[model samples]
Target: MSAAERVPGQFTLVLHSHLPWLINHGRWPVGEEWLYQSWAHCYLPLQRILRRLADDGYTDQLSLGITPVLAAQLDDPAAVAGMYEWLADWQLRAMEAAIDDDPDRRASGHREYRAAAAALDDFAQHWQHGGSPAIRDLLSTSVMELLGGPLAHPFQPLLDPRLREFSLHEGLADAQLRWGTRPSGIWAPECAYTPGMESLYRDAGVSHFMVDGPTLHGDTALGRPVADSDVVAFGRDLTVSYRVWSPKSGYPGHGAYRDFHTYDHQTGFKPFRVTGKSVPPAAKKPYDPTLVDAAIDTHVDDFVACIRQRLIDESARLGRDALVVAAFDTELFGHWWHEGPIWLERVLRRLPEAGITVGTLATARRDGYVGDPVELADSSWGSGKDWRVWEGPQVAHLVQLNREVTDTALDSLDKRLPAHGSADPGADPRDLTADQILRETLMTVQSDWPFMVSKDTAAGYAQDRAYKHAHATREICTASDAGRDARAASLAAGWRRADNLFGALDARRLPTRDWSEK
Candidate 1:
């Protein structure tokens, strides 16, 4: 809209890739193995898009945050094994369909079989063969910037202090193991934050993080620098993000986009497009990806314009280049909205040509830009872009449990700190039992649980995850203090069996600095 903004500079585009650790777990209704589906549809295809861009000499400056739990599953031997098993199974299913007798049915089945076989093969080479190192190659390619977060995607404000520390430390360490090094920016698991959390980030070496625009109040359009710490907090440019996939009325809601729900019972494939806004699922058109590609181009153009405008206004208002970061769950591109990969490819490809400069979060901070904080209110990137999704009535039990378990862990850890005031320096003070319970507690407190429950997707599993972890966290804190080591150990072991995730969380990896150099 303005000539000043067009004087080509840098803008940040951060995308968060996260999923509950559903490796060999979660089935059917709630689970749907969104992981591999997301990988095939979104992750691998998106990676290919980035590769294509790189090939054309257009390296990505886009920021990508992958949660540690998700990372762990990505790097796990079990998960890798399971993925291949699933792919082979899919190949077999496709073969069966290809041999169907009916003419029309056979043609459809043959087409699907070919697509499935292609996807399975792509996944093998792109991800499975080399493991997560392939992901590291992408990040290291100068085409993309990577971000990390807590071990599990937890509701941070309501997590045990020890768990928070443990998770972040282990999470960052896991990133180093898989993708080759630590990330200077973190996604902060659902964009959940509290007053003191920034200090933890400072302690852990994270210099930047992102939150929804509403969380920073209605004032700022771009990311702002926070007080008490140097960590820059980027806010999601929702107006742009929603152009492709908003909850109610984004392009994905159009008649031509693929339907996330309503899978073909016989093939476990979603064979239709939205085809109608208010129409029932039974009456949708067959999904034609070709039509969706044309729609993506139009929507993507509008998004670039929106970001360019935001950068112009913010740079002038804040007296420097301002970053307009549009963040979203990585799953949306392919897993949730079937044609998301197409939209993503179109957006990324069109950015440079549109004269919109995209840079990584770390690069944005390094290049010098800051926002004076007026105030930051409670918020999130949820339905209203607020906390209601995690605190609403549909998740009241989760709310109560979060409060009790988190507060209990905090109080217990506080009391234990005094004992370490003069303790031996080399002692293993990392509370393993507390850490384990807190890990489960943190994993269970993921905002996804409440959101999933609210949306009625396996509400019971969500409830059970939250409550069971809350119980373990509370019981461990109580039992440990009472010298009930046996009971504490029993509870910790039990929770590990049920809420197990990120087995690589060795206590040795915890960062020891308080407020010094991260």
Candidate 2:
């Protein structure tokens, strides 16, 4: 297994960037404010980092998945308003903190806070197009792979067939709207999968969707097809993903990095480190960006070298070329791990230098690499790389909600769907009203809403996003059920104005299965 017979050392790096639907909604926990913070800290910073790389001679290929829910919030006017307000409040909080501490330290905090606030404002304005255009241009040129998912980021397999179909339809359609190209790949909201999910992706025109590595049954290290569907399921290489961020130990646990949880509420700035998760906040070390940057350089080198070795070894062991995939949440960078963006840049830089080719699932599938389809184990990229997080005790309420809401919503739509496949008349208020109600209802059952709620970390934003989506679904259904054509249309239109993510969901695609109890 020499380099000559190892195919092209090509691999795909997929970063899933998503947030629940948070628009003119809540302030703390899960609300519009949370959206702004992530935008300011993660999304905006990440875009800038990529922009810098693109502006340079680097054509290092990367794939990004921005869910329809996140896209909607980023592009919403009310969401922008909430972001601006949050920034302003953050500045005010910093000012107050500056005056209460030692003069020198207080002044330094004030300066840093002001600078952060200004950067946030500028990033917001620069991203007026929801940062969609820049991403689209990158995809168009092939330096970046643009990926999309459902209207509300639902786990299709867990959803009722009807709702699942509608969500995928709308989600794929939304990708077309943002990237100016229909994506052939999908980043399942949680990398959650079941055997029948491949059928749904095929119906939505997706060529591939990600799955956890262990999900691919047996010793097949690369991607394998589920059932007989044309869609390919690429498994995440946990060995690689865990290099930077893992459930137990990763770079984020480094003692020099800024603490995510113990921020100074008075100043709205984090100036400490998690010396030990078990240690009290007062015992943690002072956060130092410079020290963390040094650490990142070391870790980045180790990861790149490790990848190079893995590629070499796998190509040797398999007696054929191999592909390795590393998938992660895009927000982990600037959002959860403050130095994440810096680490990413360092790693990307090292990849090309180390002779590794960056490609997306689109290119991977296109390159004729998929072979020997196998039965995939039902799994997710969660705790234990399985569905425990989703089906765990902490989140049973969410599971119940997912089952009930979807069941109820589908029943409401099914009883009223145009009989015998009657064509929807655009001019008839009742027909238009029904279509919109069914669409919203279908989008609501997306599993992402509740999974986020159950996590408790992003609990605030998750609950609000779920409730808001749920409310929209109910309102539309309630109006339609009562045959209030004009009222239903009005409410439907209002929802569209607030949350028009994708226009592709049709009531006809709702799953027609006997597992209504699921």
Candidate 3:
């Protein structure tokens, strides 16, 4: 630690890695294909970068939140098999492009071929069993702090308190089961929070969580304890974070970087650089890796300078040491922005050199970077920094469906099962039926469907998923209610083959409550 590298404040890079349960759903555009793409482009490459840094003796590089549902998919046998096939196909496509008549296409093909081959080799070495081994190794080596979230990534603000607690408990437990240690902090789904959510955090043993800056009224210079709880809330410093990627502008939009939207239909690869925002895909230049080095170098320097300046400015503004947390979706790195991993590595390396302290959310809290408690209102990191994205008029039906399914699930489970923690842990047929019902019910209320519908991105798929899960929950519950135990068990077994996840989830954990009080 050099004196020149000392800063008055700390900066934490938080990346929330999440995706809904996609296996046994659809395949292309929005399902298993989505999982395989992210696995190759984002998860594989991202882990390799962290492993390299860890091998070089870097620890606490960032906070990574892998939601329970996403982890389930990553560790699933079917997904692992599908990912290997996808990588093989990717290599074949690169080979086909390498033989193309167009010079540019051939060059791009060669580059992709090497990339695909390397990815396949890496998967075979580190991820053949499942993502858990690699992820577990990362945690064990202290490469990054793992932040857990609720099962299925439900939008907590709009969810019932009972289900929210169950999800959080099981979600953290799932992380422990996979990684051998439970996470004390979480990247709350969407960074969504209501006034009383902190108490739930306290109850779940969560020490901290992230939220958007506006949710804290932009006084994001320090972490604040929500309400009177010791559980702290860290706000994303938009000024520093959005400088890399935002709704309209970012380094990825630079003409020299590979464009995310322009794809070679034949090869299923993005083959063009972002020549200009107005340029059509046909007019865009072929992607050239040679141009990316300079872009990454320039952007990394700019980002390092920005973080240095922000730390200095924030410390002076508050007349005390400060904190700047920059959070983003983990997929935004290699998946959305081709050179993002390169830029991220450079930024993380340079910030410490530039006298800007870099650490995780856990480090910030443990080091006493917390401020006074705040009574946070209903909020999320979505459009308008509120809950409209999940509860808006456009998705009114979903909001209603979430409520109805949650209530129905509780009622049905309570009538059949003993009180919480009282049921036997054996694999009884009725217990399996209850588990499937609760699983589908949880899937129905996941926040992704409404978000996709509201954003008009894959709205059809989103609606279909929500309805499918809801209908499954209702059908199973109907059989159980009508004393058709055999039918209920059969449906549950069928669903389990497809939706099997969260082996720790049991209906016994969901406490039976008296509805008359409500």
Top candidate when judged by lDDT against the true structure = 3
Q: What C-alpha lDDT do the candidate models reach, one value each?
A: 0.71, 0.71, 0.89
TM-score of each: 0.85, 0.87, 0.97
> How well does model 3 score by local distance difference test?
0.89
| Range of the 10 consecutive residues with the lowest summed lDDT in candidate 1 | 509-518
Winner on lDDT (1 vs 3): 3
TM-score ranking from best candidate downward: 3, 2, 1
Question: Which candidate should be chosen as best, given TM-score against the real structure?
Answer: 3
Q: Candidate 1's error at 222, in angstroms?
A: 3.7
Residue-by-residue lDDT tens digits, candidate 2, 91-114: 776677678756534754776677
Clashes of each: 3, 7, 0
Give the per-residue Cα lDDT of candidate 3 at 28: 84
Q: Candidate 3 residues 128-230, lDDT tens each?
A: 9998889989998887999999999999988887788878888998999998989999999999998888989998899999999999999899999988899
Expressed as tens digits, the lDDT of each residue in 1-518 for candidate 1 is 34543634466667788777675357655453666666666777778887887777776568888887777666766667777776777777767766767443455566667767877777777767534777877876778878888777777766656567767877787788778778888887778777778789998898888888778764445456676677778777666666666657887787888787766777776777888888788787777757876777777787777767776777687676666767777878777877777777777766766677777777767776556653455666766766677788778877887777766765655544434422343465555675575576666667778888888877787777667667767878898788787888787787777544666565434333243421
Q: RMSD for all candidates, in order, please.
A: 4.4, 3.8, 1.7
- For model 1, what is the alpha-carbon lDDT of residue 86? 69
